[model samples]
Target: MKVNKKMKTSALAGAALLSLQALPASADQEYLLTITRPGHLQVIDMSTNEVVRTCDVPGKFGTGSIAPSPDGKIAYVLSNMTEDVYGFDIQTCDITFHAAQSQGNVRVKTHQSITVSADGKELYTVQNPVRHLPDRFEVMEPQLAVYNTADGTDAKPVRTFPVDRRITKIAATEKGEVILGGADIKAIDVNSGEVRMVTALQSWDRGPEWLPPDAFAMHSQGEQSNEYIMPYVTAKFQDDTMNMETAEWWWGISRVDLATGEAVRQEIIPFEFIVFNFISDPRDPNIFYGSFNTLSKHDITTGETLALYEMPHTYYDLNISADGKTIYVGGTSSDISIHSSDTLEKIGSIQLSGDMSTSDLRVATIRD
Candidate 1:
């Protein structure tokens, strides 16, 4: 995944440098985990299992992952069909920002993920772009843009680095660095705007167990050579009891070191296809946490995977407490569950008014 050493200078010349000086000190933080289902954002309070409020979103409940600013004041929602990203004020419940694609040669086909910088000045959006013109071998490139937060306006493209492969996930590191992964993971220098393929990850070999039992977890590779196709239900299982139930199905977790272009650790996490959206131990950058049906804690330094917690089955999204003491998971096996990060024990669970489905959980901590 390492870039050619010769291209380093040209790639990162005079890009905006990341500033964490303004970032507030970490403290006991609470968050609202939003899960999408029929067509609502189930806002669950982490401190107490209570539906503090339910916000109505544009598309289906979970059109795309939801992200809150580090300060916890603003939340951004993306749409699968539209090119615009919506902003919500957590305190006033008002839509403050409506960030649209202001500049670009092509229209964004699928709006994937929206991440914000640590200083809360910019919103980084990752999207797929297609040329407006027809067939001339027009390329479909992975687009990245930085939108100003002062006003819900148009975003400008900072850099559109070439990634000819599939990018399934995009995340902002604790230090305000952007990490993109699909069949492979790449770390882009936020300040310098240099994108380096961090680690090369090979896709799982397809087989019978990879397909779903009732057509719920069908797997397919689009556009690429129709060389491999399998159902998603045939996912590998660790805990057989939960594996029998469709509610518990997850791919796995892998973390790569940006300094070195290699995967430090990887584990086959049980549960449905769920993307982790929370920092496990914010104080210690190496420790992070996430869940789908089961909760996990991974240490990138030592490359160790530990079963931190598990649920009754249904688990959608999660966010870490500001201080990294507790994890708030959105959904219902029977109810929404909150677990202590240190002990990995269930502290509380509460039922929500909305039904939870297979949706990626996005969470952000705000200083209260």
Candidate 2:
């Protein structure tokens, strides 16, 4: 597809150069940031469970992946068919930064891999570029693109390095590395571009008794827990015969600590159903929640189901409140459902103007 120069120019002229405004002032408040179809960023106040503010996102909306700055002042969204990145000031709803990944005949897609540094000075993503020839398309190598947040409106990658393909999620670590989740869990240094194995997912050494696990980590809701957690499913042979009928399927979790870059992987429970996403409890280390067609609570340490409640519909992503009292399920519909963490019961819901699609439901704490 070709670039829309007129739309890009108009969006830049209207959003750029706007002065930042003060949000409803508060010493410390938790808000949920999410995007919906047709391009809109909505902020929900955790205290009132209401859509407190709505911001217009520039460019066409497709896979609206958002990564908020450290201070929660700016939200960088990957939109425009996953080829453009725009940073919106949450308070003023102004486009603070914009970067179109594609150039000329090469079309680049980030594939939902976007993140910001801990200090909020840099942004990172893995770009898969394909060159469109007159009669054929040439596949190019994937690279990690890093952008400075201060470069407004016409931002470009300050640096880029080659990386492995199929990276779907990127999370920054406090130790100057970004944890990449895809075929395997790996950490790449932002400065040196040094890549190291954090944990083996597809290449896990589980002996000849277990089948390789299948997992996908897309949502970026680890702010409250300070960890990137993902759910997976695998089957283990129950006997020496290694018969398919005697295999026991199980659910497991792999976690990467954002502060230390430490990784942990373990099977959690028997695979009973599919879970699209999972979030750990900030208040309790042993507790976590999963969402899809149902809301289920699990004991991370014991691999036990603590509580389970069927939901009204499917939700692609789920996040926890800072206080750990309420759980919010979103990303598959117009309404984000609120539930009690202790009982897993629906308590309330926040309805948006449009469907969330594959957008992330991120919890950010804004301070005065």
Candidate 3:
């Protein structure tokens, strides 16, 4: 039986409308979508920074991975409670559909393993079991499951195929291919299921000691000013020599060229601070942002650290507006903190109706 979830709008103040009306309107609407840890969704009006609507997700312990529809009218989330996926209408803040990622003793979703295509017609995610009890659970090879968004409530994978064993995050390209980023970056042909490796996270390593990536650092992969940004941290390179052990573990950002499939690594000056999420400036691709416990700005061009600010709490997710002005950070709290992207200054905060430990904040465009 599906669990009963609450769906309601927060008590928005009338004065809030007056403030929202003051802002100049655009052809497209903007909203901050927050998925809480208590398993709920909150859609906040970016104009007033107010919670316009909220819906309790079906799953209890929801994962931090959601992809907004092309129109931003709906969000398809890969949930973990019972290992299923649910779609919520962005307008009504109600459950629109529910489809299990795996069925009958099978499970999926490692972390941030869900994303929609560029055109927003399909969904992609990695299916990995959570438990490995010998007799109680049946362990299976990890696979990539593709589903059609139009399928509605009982949606099932139109096609399922084996992908890399450790793909934690999934994204798509404009040219009609799936980009899986984790320990290694690769492309897969949806129709043909051809996996082509683009590059490894340790691509910058000069010696044979290749460092595996911290997959938790990955967020949604989207084009910003014609360039794609990927944030990831690498595991330590343990060596008996004191110099190697004392040497800081390098964090990196991968910049990929969509046109030519050329991927380059931007290694940060070793261990000043750790950045686990990626947010790049739309106007200037050279400039990028990263956050987990702290928000950081980086100039990948000259390998220089620009600014760093500690967030109130450790946030697992981050998002930026289409105009490249405001930065939204959520995922581990009831409030979505807003900041000036240019300065990383706290500009405002929107408190959710419930203390829904929201996970991922996805910024997308909604049509008026």
Candidate 4:
């Protein structure tokens, strides 16, 4: 179904009013937040399956990574070709915070590494910087920049610590630590800035017969499950005589608990199809959903394919509702397709103005 563009302004004004009034104690509402190209932040009410507000973003869109506050009031967007981050009040569509990672001669980019703390007090991102010289460009070290949420529009990093390069996604844990995905999954203490390995990806000790696993974990959709999940592909020699014909390809998952920092990495099933992103069900821990050219539901514990449905097009990211009843898939196109989590059937869709590209699809729960 298509959203009415004429309701944009009026809906935003109504949302602002609702933000000021006290909501019912037991009333909880869920909304889907995402960005579209040439710059727009769209928020859709999950109950009615309609676009509520379309907030215009400040800079050029790139990856369009977003992190909503713990209370689900503000959405921090990584835009301006990943060189700048802006926080928008989803209720009023106001720019509440901004941070430009690029400086005089150096250009910085955060490749899908943006998140808010569990307490909603700080925002964190890993900045990969490069210095532009007269004749060439010099690659600089990466740093983890932290900013206070109360700093307002002209925000700056409160502190920064040197971190390993190639970090793509980050999530803050309840223990005041941030889990990072890179060559290996690592955890950094927010207060002490001490970095430690949570689990090994490329350096996994899966014996010399197995090759290093290849992982693509750019999407950040761990909020609903309260766990960071990454899907990986690897190969292993079938016998003592390592030969091309005697090898087996496999699919594995590396999951980290966002609340307790516990991590588990195991090969769930053999390599079957390409999956760009995966999210665990909040209601049922053993059930998980993945999206790409197809939508798949699997039982991670038994390596069983519970259901599979071919999608209309490829989707880069997918997220589930807090209740785990519905699934929202978007990224490649301008439409966010909704599906039934139980049956994997198409139920509805919300069409946007522009393509989402590599933008994130996030679910937010707020009081109404």
Candidate 5:
């Protein structure tokens, strides 16, 4: 059975409406962000830096990935639990409709990551079994599903691509290119619909849910003007090392050569445990930014570490405002952190209703 998940305004507070008369024009712009914690979606004001509102995402209907359509008219919330997608109107704060269902008998599992194309017409989601047997390490292979959004109805899955091993995380590039990062880094060809194995990580590896409490909580906070690098580490033993042990886990931002399935660049970052959830620059495709246990930025084009900032709280995910001038950081921290993209400064921060590490944030644009 399909269920609906919605948030109410009573749970939110309006922006403080403070004036920035002396500040630049860009400083006055505001952004509305939604984050998941337990059963609630905490809404934050990018300008005021406060938890102005809170909405309840139904407990049974878990929210996986959150994205806003191009024109900023509608937001898409993917629920792996219900095996469905919900569309919300930004201005009205209402559930408009559900995404078109997977077409031609294609099905989706719970907890899969979702992404929308740059043009905003296509929706890509990855599905993996929610539960797996522990006895045999037969990982749940992931399948990539695609959907069309024009009809404003249930999207039918157009493609079903598979992965060799279990996937830990997934991301999309500016040109609508898909890169899957985790224990192994892989890429998918959106045009040709081809999936290829790019590279296998040999260091710092771990299964899901390995992050410590402090790093996990700090990762939920997303402020501070700096870049970050985390070291990848895993257990070491004589027997484990002799048999090609699975000691290394992959973390941090990875740079890839899309034209050729090559993970041309990568770096081991600090914080042994923390899953990353954040956004990359659309304007500067090579400039990647993210936060988990810490905050960081990197330029793939120049192979340089731009900056790394340490956060007092853990940030689970990050989203950029429509213009990329503002950033909304969500996580378990008591406050919602906002940053200046240009100066990389923490301009404002507000307390939210729930802990950080909510859902993945997606920005979509609608254009005819």
Candidate 6:
């Protein structure tokens, strides 16, 4: 009986120790990976804001975007210049999924169009038609290609479906619908290949004076937004006498909920201020941070601006932390400009050692 009691105590102690080991580490120990042009990637420690590791990748250009795995173990980078999709393992520093061509050896390319399914089993990329002649390009039907992420390198699209051209960015909803970002937002049914126009900036019930512009540019649009994602655009009202060349444009943000398909559009600034991407803080939904030439923090609840400031240089990409602590800015330089979420002050920077151009800043939680 004494021996049985001792065995029970030993098992309890072992279970207690195992529970301690299973506890998650503090968020302070997290890491972030920032990619730069001319083929370089820097993984930085978020706690210390210091470089932890670096890797050089070949066949990279400035026109590519990365989609990180949900577990943050891998990053799928789509490059238009190389016409290839590469899966980069952040932990092991191994590169796989080197798909350079589509069906029938046809060279395919993408421009800031990539996303991975929630389960991390499928990868999606937009394949744009190639330019056949100078000043004139061929008009092959644009398509969305879906590949099995686990297949790696030589993976081909298990299915290809028609998609409209002029799609600048890509994101997915929980229901497997693809959100196509452009002048107007569209939701494409992946299985049916049906394109539905959910939200057009002009479709909103604004007055007759409101005008939606012809183009919208967002650098870091392929991100994970639990609420929704919106791209900043410039459009304004003009007087009957005002010429199109003379009228100033106003900046605004329009977002559509993936769950309900409801959209909301509101003007942030009344003048022509450039904004690349305007993403909100989930911790505080009213507060949003974005960039164009300046890193700005604004509150949608209050008409008053929160904070707007210049950076070390111009940047196009900006992402607010999940906890709303830091704003990671990239897309134009070799540094990930880190700033305080409240004060908008320049605190620290992740500077690279060489001449590089950074694009698309994303913060992922690395899972064990």
Candidate 1 residue lDDT tens string, 1-368? 89876677655642322234456656644556564555555555555657676666665343445656767777776643546677777655677777555335566643345666656777776666666666553556665666677765444554454543455445565455666655545666666677765544444443434322211111111101101111122244344344544543543344433223234323334443343333446567657565566687766456466655666774645556655686666644435677888867988866755565544444444554
- Candidate 4 deviant stretches above 4 angstroms: 1-25
Over 4 Å off, model 2: 1-26
- Model 5: residues >4 Å from true position, as ranges? 1-32, 38-45, 50-64, 80-82, 97-107, 110-112, 129-141, 173-177, 199-252, 256-263, 268-313, 318-328, 339-347, 361-368
Alpha-carbon lDDT of model 1: 0.53
For each candidate, what is the lDDT?
0.53, 0.88, 0.70, 0.89, 0.51, 0.69
Q: Please identify which of the two predictions, 4 or 6, would achieve the higher TM-score against the true structure.
A: 4
Question: Lowest-scoring 10 consecutive residues by lDDT in candidate 2?
Answer: 17-26
Tell me the spans in candidate 1 whose CA falls farther than 4 Å from its real position.
1-29, 60-62, 80-82, 101-107, 131-139, 153-161, 173-177, 190-193, 203-263, 266-290, 295-310, 316-319, 322-325, 331-335, 340-347, 356-358
Per-residue alpha-carbon lDDT of candidate 5 for residues 176-273, written as tens digits (9 for 90 to 100): 56665545556777667676655545432434323211111112111121111122333333342333244333344434543333454344333244
User: Model 4, range 1-368, lDDT digits (tens) per residue?
Assistant: 86677788789878988986756556677888999989999998888989899999988887989998889999999999998999988878999999988989999999999999999999999999999999999999999999998999888898998899889988999999998889899999988899999989888786768878998787969789888987789888976576657688778888999989989998877678888888989999889888999899999889898999899899999999888999999998999989999999999999999999999998778865
Off by over 4 Å in 3: 1-26, 80-82, 129-136, 202-205, 208-218, 221-228, 234-242, 245-249, 257-262, 354-358
**Deviation in angstroms for 122 in model 2?**
0.3
lDDT of 4: 0.89
Task: Name the candidate that leads on lDDT.
Answer: 4
TM-score for each model: 0.61, 0.91, 0.82, 0.91, 0.58, 0.83
Candidate 3: tens digits of C-alpha lDDT, residues 301-347: 78777888888787766778778898887766677778898789999
TM-score of 6: 0.83
* Cα displacement (Å) at residue 365, model 1: 2.7
